[model samples]
Target: MRTFDVPSAPAFWQDPHSFFSSSETAQGGVFASGDGAVSVLGFDALDQLGRNPALDGHPFPAGGMGSPGLDALLRWGLFALTAPEHQPLRRAVAAGFGARRIETLLPLLRRAAVEHCREAARRGQADLVHDVAAPLAGLAFCALVDLEPLQAGALVAAVEEIGRQLSPDSAPDGTEAAGQQAEAVLEMLRALEAAGASPLMRDIAERLPPDTPARPADLVAALVLDSIETMTAGLACALDCLLRQSGVAEAVAADRYGWPLAVQEAFRLTSPVLLTARMAQADIAWQDDIIRRGTTVMLWWPSGNVDPRRFERPFTFEPLRPQARHLAFGTGSHSCLGRQLAAMLAEELAAALLPKEGQRAIRIGETVFLQRFARLPREAPIRFA
Candidate 1:
């Protein structure tokens, strides 16, 4: 119940496992980071954070939301919505990511993976982050949204530039840098608009409320950018996890059916999305403390994933670990709509990238953290043997 200034130490970003453990020691399961951000640690607290009705991802001033520029975006996008307004969009997005949809896209996913991996083979060494993860998100996203696949490379570039400018590793110059990155993300949408709306935009328009102000292209373009950020980072993280754990690839190879579990375990350990701001929908009591409405509490995921009380040796990579529980895609109505696709992409990519028998094991290079976000990696290079 006491306040400790949030430690923004370098170790917290580069070596978070120890950093978060030290935070648990210093602040217990819940403590306020003097910067008006309170981190809730531990697996139990995370479960509560997920189910707690009073907590939601509505964003706040400190959370980098509610700019006049983002009005149409938040109004139409699932990332910022809450309650009744969020339900419809959530269902629509969910339908888009249904098992059938992912299954239908599997062939295309495999084709794209083959193309990227083949390119990596030709080069003998490639950054999987760029060659594998980014293209996977770009091409798969376009296919899902019914957009022309030709625009994918541009989306990949825009998403990367946007991520680079916005990540914590970038050491943002201040509000101006953020404003610039924000404009760049919007420009990605403009680029999409200039090319004209595809059937994807029309489908999204049918799902959104008729009163929504933005045209279908404008709204869908904004939403796809949001999806691109999360999807790209997530695929990169999952693949990076596989590269980090040598034993994992063997386990995956032994039981190709278990790639899903490998991907799940990967998500548990090094999720790109570590911090989520949840505004108190109403005054809510937690562990004898009060969370006031308008309060933006931070749900720090790294602490929860490694909470000693839950998984034994939480940091150890265990692809076949029984019963994985993670918040990589968040929870509740605000949970990621493209989550299944991300997982599917990860699973399929693992199958594609797995080194075959008699072939040398894939060699992994060192990790480079994204400048704008410490939790996410910037590049993961690999050399096929």
Candidate 2:
């Protein structure tokens, strides 16, 4: 029941693990910020909280961003939808990425990975972030949505611009930036619709009832906006883990099966997504107090993965450790729908980047942190042989 201000200090972002590991956060597993927002920590606690109906997926608050166009686009996206409305849309989107669809795209995904990795090898030194991870994510996303590979760079750039509006530090920077990004998305969606829609978009449209409020293009945009950054960051993180840990890359290179374990461990150690927000729909009882209706609940996911109670040597990156309970892709109905595709891309990239016998990549600079997320620099050079 103690009210602590939300952790927004620069120092906190610089070192979130310290706060998560402290007794203060671990004691009750929940802390209330002065603004009535509640932050829930730990894997077990979040698993339990996710099942409670009172806390539903959060929506982008109207007028909060000072850009009506941007706010509208965000609100209409899948992340803002609730129950009844949310389930059908979610199912439709999931169906679009069905096993057959991804399986068919496997060769293409592998080819893209190989191409990027080959280019990195040609240079003998490359920035995996922009040169490899970003393009891989962008191209994979394009393939999923039936967009041309040529559009990948533009789409990726637009999504990055859109993402800036979602950050906690985001402030009203006038409507110009948000509006431009919104228009760019609308333009792309219109083009896709004109081109008779991608198979995924068509599947989504066919699956939903004619009366459903969501447009197929909106769902595609939602997926792109929500997933691309995470995918790019995840690949970069996994590579960073391999480079820092030593021998892991060679182990994976020798046995493709090890890719899953290494990728999962990377996710556990540094989740691309640090937190998710839920809104309390009604007054709910806590251990000794109440979460009033309309209060925002923050689920610090990375903290849960690193919780001392759940795993032995939580901070250490042990690829062999069981990864069953990590909240990397989150839990419950809103868990990542594109997780399979994301994992496949990472595995394929790893396979291509590390050969059975070749010089390995060495990090040229320290990994950078953007708030709680592990974001690589635009050019975090890595030498390869």
Candidate 3:
């Protein structure tokens, strides 16, 4: 087996397709990366790994492969564990982001779009990511997950700053920016607690048993941190997909139920959160090698999401594609509990931002991809008239 020496940095993430293909062709689906990590490619392989009861999704104290302070956000959260250990907290947090609850948040979601429009009106140009997607995601997270809407501005900053913890430069150790961001978010939450606890927080606490591994505050903080980072990335990238492809956008716009389809399709393409790592619980036989137990296995979802065998015209964004079910949110016990809510949020924003009658198609300016984390558009300037 050849060593897959892809560096653990943004440069490799820049073209995961090339890496996936080269790695797969070179090693027949499994190889060792430069970071001493084992990675697997292909849609079938990823799905099988995701459902492998032997592999653990959360195998780290702080969220896997992240910096200390940034990962500390999930220190009390269940994000770093698989089933059995993670189930109770997952259920508790899932309810808060349920579809019905999301429906209640429709007004806030629409308000985010309205506020973006207002910002554009004032400046004639603005970053859709920072101004529209990030703030919208931040506020939604604040109300639904944090239950502390007043700290939204700080949450936005913290989420952005902490997200940098995933950058190649900060890998394996928390960066100074990450520490500062964590301090900001935690301080804000601490202040909010001094005032009073919201029903959402209390409900989450009540749901967990006395012996639960996750503390109530950790659960709240984890949910808050997640709500902003990846959600914001998914929203920004999905919109970028539609805005850049007029043919696909027009097709989606023509359908009454197209917004969600567009979101799902774009999700398959970008897969904002690209790779998820799992630890093997038992020795597994690979093509010609033995994968020892306790070895870390990286499931590259972006590769699977665009696997030609699974997705016809894998590179194209085709809404309502029959084989459209993708692993943007992963699968099995550790799947993203907020999948439905995330989809709803994206669809709502798409509906609001999709070109209206007599209005110009939304235009996108230069974009900067995060490379790590969600591959999100760090700077997505956009406008419509």
Candidate 4:
């Protein structure tokens, strides 16, 4: 049995295959015997194991007991709120967030991103995560959801807090605070439903089957919350990659095509969501391992992204790689709804901020990996002459 020490906290930020690669293992499986779970390290392995409903069940972690049933309530509430039932809502929302919508928004998004970056440049030093990425992502999400600026910011903060609370190391008080914030956001959505202010909600209301119990408010609220949380994390991860890669900043300035491809590579490399969890519905044998019914499986996307078998020179950033298949937004039935929008926003921000020749170093300060940012400093001493 192979043994590896597990990090105290989930090392979503760290490269998991750094210590050991599946090629090194005697058998195909990257078994962390100490961690008591099999690591799906390759894209093929991930494709087979990650989406297996019997193995990998749902993305959200199983709820903790005795929390006023807050997690369950939130899940059910979201399911009840989106339009055309849960499954249909997923399909329609995906359609709405298609390539067409993203293409249309590119110009406007690019303008906003550039202006924001210019403002940051003038400041000499700014938190890239907070000042640039966060705001840009929040605004992009708002545009997609038709939310007002101030309301979008609030929603961003609340969703960020929820992500923070999911961390194993979060303080009890902080977790409680996040729950309250999420509840408040839900209340706001409920109020919006009552007032009939949002056209998206109205569209959903009109689309639902006559017998469906799902409400438009529930769907809208769930999408809003999910979009802000995931998009913000994606933005931060993309910025971190841009800062780390040599010449990427200058490349963004020089070539328009460079930034978009670079953003895609970054997304492929630094998958913001570390692992997705799923509960087993039936007994299954995966490779040499037997996964019994009711066992929880974790599909590790970060590990899969770096798997050498799947990605050639996985650690190296190759913007022009011809074939790049990444699970950053997930796969199959649970794939992210805002993927195109998220990609557009990230690309636009990179193009805007990294351009303008002779900009100073973009520094990243303390960041919480998958949680809220403590600080992200992007300093540039600009000479307008």
Candidate 5:
């Protein structure tokens, strides 16, 4: 295995914009050094690397805590469900997210968005991250997985715990708690499978061929874990953007597509998954740097997204800026599976909050790098008039 040096202070994991700004050379080049490889990509190079298969698949390092033995479970689940052996099962699951299915669910999503706003209005002052964003994300996940609406909150909490456990500094007690939660979640999945109820469970059961070797519990666990972590982080980032932007909340309420674009822009700026790595299949030269066949390649999504050479006024939050290609959801086979769902949630949440005017402006009180939120105060005191 090729050895790579850990980044001393990775801006992608902390403040992505500052990282790019600091790394910019007088010649308009951005130098990236990590994992014993030094490569420079012009701001515009993101298109070539992010979209093109030849350059986009480089593996990058993962920041933060390692999941305790759960990574294996995730890999196994993905292989069993999406690999060639499970094509039929994959196709079946995809049907639930088909155009018709998503269309059918749009009304429910709108209602949920309205209800979330009503509840927040009742509280007057609410923690936007926990009370609003979290529940909104949870509901989106529930829709994707076909879980009961009432169970979304608990399921989201369990998934958040799993993500927290991935942090390297998690104490023994925290780890123990996470394990317990995981077990409980697994048990719930088992119970759901046994009951043969719930559209999601029934669809999964019916679609997965009898001869397939994938277990229901493993599949459910993977879905729940992946759904929760990505959705929560994405929603938090989206909310952060609305709080920073002027009139975005109102625009979202007035226009259906307005907030979704803003959310996408935020995703580009604050890539939730900072670094991803892939082992080189063969020796390749990247802009004069030779990457040997066995080397592990790391792709920096945040850096690539904001390269001044690529994005005009890269630091500014201009949602209306013409469509710019970004690596927020990644590319090729490894691209995120739930990009559409994330966009939908961001749009709905922004729209819902727009009507409650005179609410306190949202503020992020304390932020810990790589951690979702320590405290996000949304002291929006409001009443539904």
Candidate 6:
């Protein structure tokens, strides 16, 4: 197998798009690390791997992410579940994000978007991400679990604290302070459930079987953990794409109906949530080698999204391209459960903010990335007219 040392690859950390678009990954589409982990880069290969039952979706190793709270997040989170345990929990959470439910939240999302845009317009300047996208995501999250939108700031802070531990650059030895933060979040969730204040907890309880291993609060925590960052990142990236391209923002703003296609293309180009992993449950056959059980297979989403074999002019942004679908949200059983919510948030925010004619946002700073799966920029500054 071709070797690609992912940990030492500075480009992969500093600038993932260029790293994945390189000729090495475009040619072979597969690589093996010194630690025996395999990376799959082809769209078709990733699709096949996602569907393969021999691979387990549970992400954490046996020793866990270092603390009981962190370990619980890894073990009980929806994306990390496997087989018998996964289906029921998925169904429960999926109920909250159903079409009827999302439709009910549309007005709320639209109102929040308009309010944020109004504030930006009054100031004549704003951070496109922080002032707009992040707040919209926070409002959507509060709506989902039945919290007041006013509580969004505090809720977002708690989730971010928990999420920091999952970053690649997080300290190897979990800090005592970090552990306390995780514990506090978990304890608050449990307390909310006990007091009957969490509608998400009730939704899960209604759908989940009586003997289920996971607590209702755990499922709610997982949903909160997964929802805000990805939705916020996706909206910011799509908005960034529109602002950078010359006529695209004006065209999308005029059409209204075109935002979905625009967001889809942006997702293809930027490919948020760079990678996902699965553990081989049994021996598997590859092109010229065997993948033994217990091996970790990393699915590189950016590589698959830009595969030359699958996309014509793969590097270019074309919303109306013939093959518009991509693996930004992944595929198969463990695919993102909140994909619909993410798309809705992006479209609504774009529709609300983009006005008819000459008023629009102009980018003032370059986008950046942190050592995390989410490709969201720390600051994407813009001025509104």
Clashes of each: 9, 0, 0, 8, 12, 0
lDDT of 6 by residue, 30-75 (tens): 6786588988877777777777777777556655667776666556
Poorly placed runs, candidate 3 (over 4 Å): 1-3, 7-11, 22-28, 34-36, 61-71, 82-84, 146-148, 171-177, 190-196, 284-290
| TM-scores of the models, in the order given | 0.85, 0.92, 0.87, 0.81, 0.76, 0.92
The lDDT per prediction is 0.67, 0.74, 0.69, 0.62, 0.58, 0.75
lDDT of 3 by residue, 1-385 (tens): 5665554655565555656663463335677775557877778767876777776664555445344555666565444666566666777766545677667877877777666666564576667787777877777877675455666778888776676665555554557677767766666665555555655656666677678766556666766666677788788878777777666546665664478778899888878777777777788776687767878877777878888778889888678789988988777666666666677778777766665543433665566776565667768777666
Q: What does candidate 1's lDDT look like per residue over 1-385, in tens digits?
A: 7664554776565556566664473334666766566667667776676678777666424435424443333455665556655666556555545677667898889888877877777778888777788778889888876667886887677656555544554444443444444465566556655565544544555676665455555555556656777787788888877766666657756675388888888888886667766777788777767767777677767777777677787888776666488877766556667778888888878777775553332647677765333255667778877
Worst 10 residues of 3 by lDDT: 355-364
Which prediction has more favorable lDDT, 2 or 6? 6
- Of the two candidates 1 and 6, the one with more favorable lDDT, higher being better, is 6
lDDT of 1: 0.67
The TM-score obtained by model 3 is: 0.87
Question: What is the alpha-carbon lDDT of model 2 when measured against the actual structure?
Answer: 0.74
As a whole number from 0 to 100, the lDDT of residue 206 in candidate 5 is: 67
What's model 6's overall lDDT? 0.75
Compute the lDDT of residue 368 as modeled in candidate 1.
74
For residue 100, give model 2's deviation from the true position in Å: 3.0
Taking the tens digit of each residue's C-alpha lDDT, what string does model 2 give over 1-385?
7654667776665456666764655666778876779888887777777667777778876776666657656765665677667778888888887878987888999998887888788889888788888888899888888888999998778766766666555556735686688677767976796688688888888888667877887777766777787787777777766667767776775674488787788778766666778888789787776888988888777778788788889989787776545777677777777777778888888777766767556777766555534333334568786
* Collision pairs in model 4: 57-278, 57-279, 58-278, 81-218, 81-219, 82-218, 82-219, 127-376
Model 1 lowest lDDT segment of ten: 65-74
The TM-score of predicted model 2 comes to 0.92
Q: Once model 1 is optimally superposed onto the true structure by TM-score, how far is the C-alpha of residue 15 displaced, in angstroms?
A: 2.3
Candidate 1, pairs of clashing residues? 167-372, 167-373, 168-371, 168-372, 168-373, 169-371, 169-372, 170-371, 170-372
